[model samples]
Target: MTSLTTTQRQIVESDLGQCITHEKLLGEGWSNTVSCINNKWVARFPHTPESTQVAVEKQFLYAFGKGSPINLPNLKQTEGNYCLYPLLDGKRLNLEEAAKLSHQEKQKACHQLGEFLSWLHTSSFTDENLSTAPYGEADFYQDLWQYVAEALPCDLRLKAEAYLDSYFTTVPDEERKPVICHGDLGLNNILWDNSNAISSIIDFTDLFLCDPAYDFNAFYSYFGQKWVNMMSETYTPHIGDHFWQRVTFNKLRKALFVVYYARHFGYESYIPGRIESIKESLSQQLI
Candidate 1:
C-alpha cells in the first residue's frame, strides 16, 4: 500500500483543526504533513510514526526565542498531534533565495544568523525548570561514530570510523569547548520573509551539542564555497576563531550521518547520494 499523500494529510489536518473547508496543500517536508489551517495558520504534523523525535522543537522555540534578536517561528498552539505555526510572509528560502538578494542584504542576514547561533551555543541548557538530557562533548562524537559504523556500508563505514578515531586521538578532551548546538542547521530548514530576511526556523528536532562547527556544515552543503569567506568574516568579529575545526569535523561527521539514516530507514535512493557526499568529504577533509 502506498503511504498517505499530501491530500490525505490535508484531510487529517482538517480533521484535527475541525475546519469547515480545507484549503491548499502548502508543501510536504521530509517527515511532516504541512497544510493551510483556516486559510491563515500553517499546520505541520508528523506523517510517519518514526517521525516524532528526541529534540523538543516546540520547547526550544519557546526558550530560544524569548530574548533573541533574530526571529524564529512563533508557536501558536498545539492540538493532539499537530502544532500550529504562525504564517510568515517568507517564501522557500533554500540557497537559491540568497542569489535574489543583493550582497549587502546577504551580508546582513548572515551576520544576524551568526549572532543568533552564537547566543544559542553560549546559552546553557540545564534541567532546573525543563526536562532534558545530560550531554558531554566526547560522548556526542562517540555516539555519532557508533551510529555511522552501524549505518554505512562496511568498507566506507569502517574507514570513516578510523578517520574519526585518529582525529580525536591526538586532541585532548580538556581542550574541547562545550556548547549547545543546533543538531540540524541548514538552508532548507530556514525561512525568509518578503523583505529577504530570515523570518523563521521551522524544525528543531535535532538539538544537541558537540561543536558549533556542526551548525555551519550547512554552508558547504547548500550555499557553496561562495558563502564561506563572507560567513567567516561575519562570525569572527563576534565569536572569535573557535568553530572552524569543529565545522570541518562536522562536515565529515554529517556525511556519515546521511549513510546512517539511509541504512536504518531503508531509503535506498539516499544511499547513492550519501555515498557521493561522503566521498566529497573524504577528498576535502581527510587530507
Candidate 2:
C-alpha cells in the first residue's frame, strides 16, 4: 500500500463527490500514479503537469474501447491532473502468477489474447497525430545503445553491440503498414480473473501506431517462443517473413531501455531484473 498526498486525496474526494474512506495504491508507472478508491473506482494521476497522457488515454478509451471484446477501463471522470474509472476486477498477470496456471488455462488465456489482438490490429483508427515510427529502427537502437552502453556490464555491452550490428545488417524494411498497438503489452498490463481468464487489458498510455510485431515482444519475453506460437494460432493478421525476427529485436531493445531508464529515473528496483533479462537474451542467442 502507498500513501496519497493531501492534494491527491482532495482530488479524489472532489471528483467522486464523497470522502475516500479506503484508498490503496494500485501501482506507479513511468507516467502515472494509480490508486484504487474504496475498492470500486480506480484513479490515475499523471506524474507531471505537462503530460497529455491522461487526456489522450481518456479520448482513446471513450472513442474506441466501448465494443471491445475484452473489458477496458470505463473512465467515469477526467480532469487535467487525474482521471477515474470503475476498477476492473482482476489481478495483474505477472510472470509468477502466469506460471501458476495449468496448461489448459494457459491455452484459454492465449486464445483470448490472440482474439483481442486480432480485433485491435484489424480495427481502423485514422488518427495521423497518433502515428509513430516503429521502435526497432536502426537509428533509434543506435541512439539507445549510445545512451545506455556505458552503464551496462562489459560482457553484456559487447553482446548488445554485436546483436545490434547483426540486427541492422539483416533487418528488413517496413513491409507492413503501421497499426494501432498497445505499445506496452507486458504481463504487468494484462489482468487475470478468478476464473483463470484474461479479465482486461489496462494502461493505454503508450498506445500508438507501430509494427504489429512490436506488440508480441512482451509476450515472447515473458512466456517464451512456444507460448507466442500458441498466441499466433488465432492471431489473424498475415505474419511477414521477418515478423519473429522483429519480435526478438523488440524484446531485447525493450529490456535495454528499461534497464537504463530505470536507473536514470531512480527506479533502482527495476534495474536488476532487466539486467538479468539482457544477460539471458544474449546467452540464449535470442537476437
Candidate 3:
C-alpha cells in the first residue's frame, strides 16, 4: 500500500476508477512529492510553490522531445497540482553502482551524455513558458553566498566568500552566454540501464537559462574532474577556457545550499558528504 494525502488519493482514484493498486512512494525532491501507481504510472504533486513549474516543464518536453538525443519523460496526465507520466524504464544509479562500471563504459556514458547536453544547450527552442529571471552569473552567485553565509562554519563560509569575490573579478558578465540548464542534473536524476548506459534523464523542475558550465557542476559532484574533462572534450565548442572555474563556482553554490538547508530540508543525512564535496571542489579550483 502507498500513502497519499486526500488530494493525491482523490486524484488517483478519480483517474483510475478507484481500482488503482500497488501504490508506493518513489521519493521527494525539493519541489515535488513523487510516487508510483500500479508500477506503471508515476504521480507528482507540488510540495512547494516552485513545483508548479511542471506545466512549463511539460512544454519543454513537448518542444524538444522529438529531436532529443537522450530519452526524456513523456507527459501523460495533468490535473490541478498533480502531474502523471509512465514510469520510465531502468533504475537510478547510486555512486557505488556507477563505480562498478568499467572505465570504458563510464567514458561511453559521458560521451552519450555530452552529446545530449550539446543538443540541449544549442537548442533554438524558446517560449514564454520558461523562467525569465533577470539575473547574470554574478547575481546568482550572490544569492548562493547569502544563503550559505549562515549555514556553513565560519571558516568555510569565509573561504566561499573569497572564492566568489575572486570569481566575479576574473570572470565577468561579458564572458557569460546563457544556455538552457537542466538545473539539477545530479546522479539521482539520471537513470541507467542494465549495460550501464544512460536510459533517461528526469526532473525538470529546476530548468532555467544560465551558463552552460553550470550544468557541469553535477559532473564534479558525482564523478569528479576526470569525468568532467572527459565529458567536456566531447561536448564541443560550447565549453569555454574558464570552464573549470565556472564549474567549481557552481559546485560551491550547490554545496552551500545543501549545507544550509540540510536539516531544515529533511536531508540531514546528506550533510557530511556534501560538506566534504564542497571542500574538495574548493581545493580543485584554479583560482
Over 4 Å off, model 3:
13-18, 49-51, 132-142, 150-159, 172-174, 259-287
Model 3 TM:
0.83
lDDT of 2 by residue, 84-156 (tens): 8898888876688787899999988888888888988877765534646322323565545565566667877
> Rank by TM-score, descending?
2, 3, 1
What local lDDT does model 1 show for residue 191? Answer: 75
C-alpha positional error of residue 1 in candidate 3 after TM-score superposition, expressed in Å: 4.3
Clashing pairs in 2: none
Worst 10 residues of 2 by lDDT: 128-137
Candidate 3 residue-wise lDDT, 123-200, digit = tens: 786666566342222345454456545555677667767877788889867456777878888788898888889989
Please give me the total number of clashing residue pairs in predicted model 2.
0
For candidate 3, which ten residues in a row score worst on lDDT?
A: 132-141
**Model 3 alpha-carbon miss at residue 9, Å:** 2.6
- Per model, state how many residue pairs clash: 1, 0, 0
- lDDT at 140, model 1: 40
User: 1 or 3, which is superior by lDDT?
Assistant: 3
lDDT of 3 at 112: 81
Q: In model 3, how large is the Cα lDDT of residue 67?
A: 83
Q: Give lDDT per model, in order.
A: 0.60, 0.76, 0.73
Give stretches of model 2 more than 4 Å off.
126-139, 151-162, 268-273
